[model samples]
Target: IGIFMWVSSTEASWQDFRKPCIAVVDAKTPTTRIIRAVSVVLLPFLVGFLGYNSMKPSTDEPIELRTVHPAPPASTKVHGKTFVLQTASNPYRVDDSGKYSDKVQNDYKDGNPWDEKAPQFLQYVREGGQIFFQNCHFCHGDNLNGRGMFAFAFNPIPANFTDAGTIAQLQETFVFWRVSKGGIGLPREGFPWASVMPPWEQHLTIDEIWKVILFEYWHTGYYPRTWD
Candidate 1:
């Protein structure tokens, strides 16, 4: 009880001692007096500035929470042709049955793509593989998982088709627009960005582009989402 009283009394004495007394301030020089006056006026603004900076979000964080499949335009033009995204479909996403065949697509994943007897869909997949290996492998890697030989050179590297966020969630037509337009494909009015992806339209034909997309789905076993 005595110890508690002593500590309380001591703390009260310290608080009394710390109380500001205007007469106690030693502004002996003109400069010292000016500095004190300026500090009195500027301290609140300085504190406010620091507090605001501390509370605000950073401009660059390396991590971005972005829509992997952003809303695509209703109609997009590429290579002297316009594709209506809502109605468009992947022509190569078919087998000998004349439509998508789950069994055929699954079997081709393990089988040789370069074989002479490869089914029609598999044949397109083979050609797509050729295009990917020739152009995309350096950045997307041989596995089409985005870790290519040249992948290390880029800050973000290429898109990993294996990830559910990328190819799996996107429509084939949307994918087509991205490839054809590359970095310039992003919505112009929404935000500003500069992508390193080359617009494939300048180099590859529409047929080649479709074939590359076909190979990607076959290799990954992902079907593009259909527009309802």
Candidate 2:
């Protein structure tokens, strides 16, 4: 009777539970359905997000914040007839007459003993030419004709040293003064323009200045007579 009951129960359970459907559904159909669902859900978001980023306008980053404080106004005072200052970049102009004092011109003279001999003068010219070529050639032409490469860029243009009249009129002391003090200390009517001629007095020895003076004189045919 027990064996019979057990068999009946087993049969009941088997009838209640159907066998698993092992019959393979078309794999392509389910795969396509899953792929379609994922595509439908994800494609619009991916495309829209990428498109939005691409369409957004570019913006510059903010500049660094800063504070600026300008320097105080410069002080001025007259010393004797001229003004002295902490910064010599621009000296005080004395008169409105556009003339600098002779005191300033006298300041440039070195009082070197002049040699009259041609060989000595020639030697001075050669040395002066070398120095001028090394230092001044960038602004003054190689032949001293004032056609240097830098002359083109100058607003007032460099003086034409080759002009006989101009060369003859220029004093050696005047040349030395211009070289020593530069355009800043020059009379308003003299240089009358800005320049890059540095204060060569600090860099060149007194003898070198005389040599350059002699060289310029010789180059412009003022030498032998002017050397002394």
Off by over 4 Å in 2: 1-118, 188-191, 223-228
* lDDT digits (tens) for residues 1-228 of candidate 2: 875566457766545443221212222467656665556667778999899999998795444432111121233222222222223221111122334332322222232323453233344556777788887877878888878989888655566777765556644544555666555544454333456567676677656765676566556654221222
* Alpha-carbon TM-score of each model against the true structure: 0.68, 0.43
Candidate that would win on TM-score: 1
**CA displacement after TM-score superposition, residue 41 of candidate 1 (Å):** 34
What are the per-residue Cα lDDT tens digits for candidate 1 across 178-220?
8888876778764434357788999899989988998898788
How does model 2 score by TM-score? 0.43
Residue 67 in candidate 2, Cα distance off native in Å = 42
RMSD of 1: 8.4
Worst 10 residues of 2 by lDDT: 65-74
- Model 2: pairs clashing at backbone N, Cα or C within 3 Å: none
Backbone clashes in each candidate structure, one number apiece? 1, 0
